[model samples]
Target: MAMEASEIESLIRTGIPDAHVEITDLAGDGNHYAARVVAESFRGLPRVQQQRRVYEALGGRMGGVLHALQLTTAVPE
Candidate 1:
């Protein structure tokens, strides 16, 4: 089954409590999604690491229940 946007957001928030997360359904099929995450905790992390953190938040759902996720990360200004 496809994941819900709220579930995605909740997972990220649970993992990164200080993060500001915005989720968009790219395909409207609940499979493809775009997520923009901003957090002070990401300040010194590399982009790949930042993305890893978000993926980790999803708890191994990336290639299973969640298929395509276009992710963007940024440090809070």
Candidate 2:
């Protein structure tokens, strides 16, 4: 089954409490998503680590139920 956008947002928020998360359904399919996450915690982290943090927030669902995610992370300006 495809994961809901709300579920993805909730997971990210739960993991990164201060994050500002925006999720988009790229293909109009529940399985594909594009997420833009902004967090103060990401300020000093490298891009890879920032992405990893978001992935970790998904709790191992990345290649399973969550299929594909186009993710972007940034620190608050």
Candidate 3:
């Protein structure tokens, strides 16, 4: 099963209400995606932790239904 881009965005927003999330289907396939997430909550967090937050929002679909993701995270400017 492949995950939809909207689902990804929805999950991120659900997990981090204050986040600004952008999701792209890199391979034109729902299984592969790239997401850029910006949030005030990410401030002072390590890169790994920021990325972890996004991954957690996905509800453990990273290596199953979602397949692969190229993720970028940052604090709001």
Candidate 4:
């Protein structure tokens, strides 16, 4: 099963409500995706921790519906 970009965005939004998210289909197929997320929730966290939070938001969908995700996470300026 492939995961659509919107699905990924939805999961992210569920975790961080006020997030600015951008999703791209890296391989044209929905299997591979890249997401850039900006949110205030990341302010008190480290970069790796921020990314882990996003990964956790996927809720074990990473290897199933979503094959791979290239993620960039950050706090808003």
Candidate 5:
């Protein structure tokens, strides 16, 4: 089953307390989502590390409840 958008957002927000997140359903299907996250925690991290951090925050929901996620992470200037 696909995960709730709020739950997904909550999980990410909880992991990165000061995150600015934007979630989009690319195919009008809940299974496919794109999340753009900006957080202070990613300040000095590499692009891969930043994205990985967000994935880790999901705690293994990536291929289960949460399906495909086109994720992007950035730090606010």
Candidate 6:
């Protein structure tokens, strides 16, 4: 099953309440998406860690309901 953009946003927000998440359906299909997440909590984290946080928010849905995700993370300037 494919995951909805709103559901992806909701899950990220749930895990990172202070995050500013932008989710896009790259293929016009729910299976493919791109997400750019900005948060104060990510300020000092490494790139890998930042991505991990976002993945963690999904609660292990990366390969299940969600098929492909091009993720970007950053600390707000």
lDDT of 5 by residue, 1-77 (tens): 87877788999999888999899888877899999999988988899999988998899999888889999888897
lDDT of 4 by residue, 1-77 (tens): 78879989999999889889999999998888889999998999999999998988889898877899999998989
* Pairs of colliding residues, candidate 3: none
**lDDT tens string, model 3, 41-62?**
9999999999999889889988
- In model 2, the runs with Cα more than 4 Å from the true position are none
Backbone clashes, each candidate: 0, 0, 0, 0, 0, 0
Model 5 poorest 10 in a row by lDDT: 1-10
TM-scores for all predictions: 0.98, 0.98, 0.96, 0.94, 0.92, 0.97
- Where is model 3 more than 4 Å wrong at Cα? none
| Candidates' C-alpha lDDT | 0.97, 0.97, 0.93, 0.90, 0.88, 0.96
Q: For model 4, state the Cα shift of residue 27 in Å.
A: 1.0
> In angstroms, how far off is 21's CA in candidate 6?
0.4
Candidate 1 has a TM-score of 0.98
- Report the error of model 4 at residue 40, Å: 0.6
Model 4 weakest lDDT span, ten residues long? 57-66
RMSD of 6: 0.5
lDDT of 1 by residue, 12-63 (tens): 9999999999999999999999999999999999999999999999999998
**Roughly what TM-score does model 4 have, to 2 decimal places?**
0.94
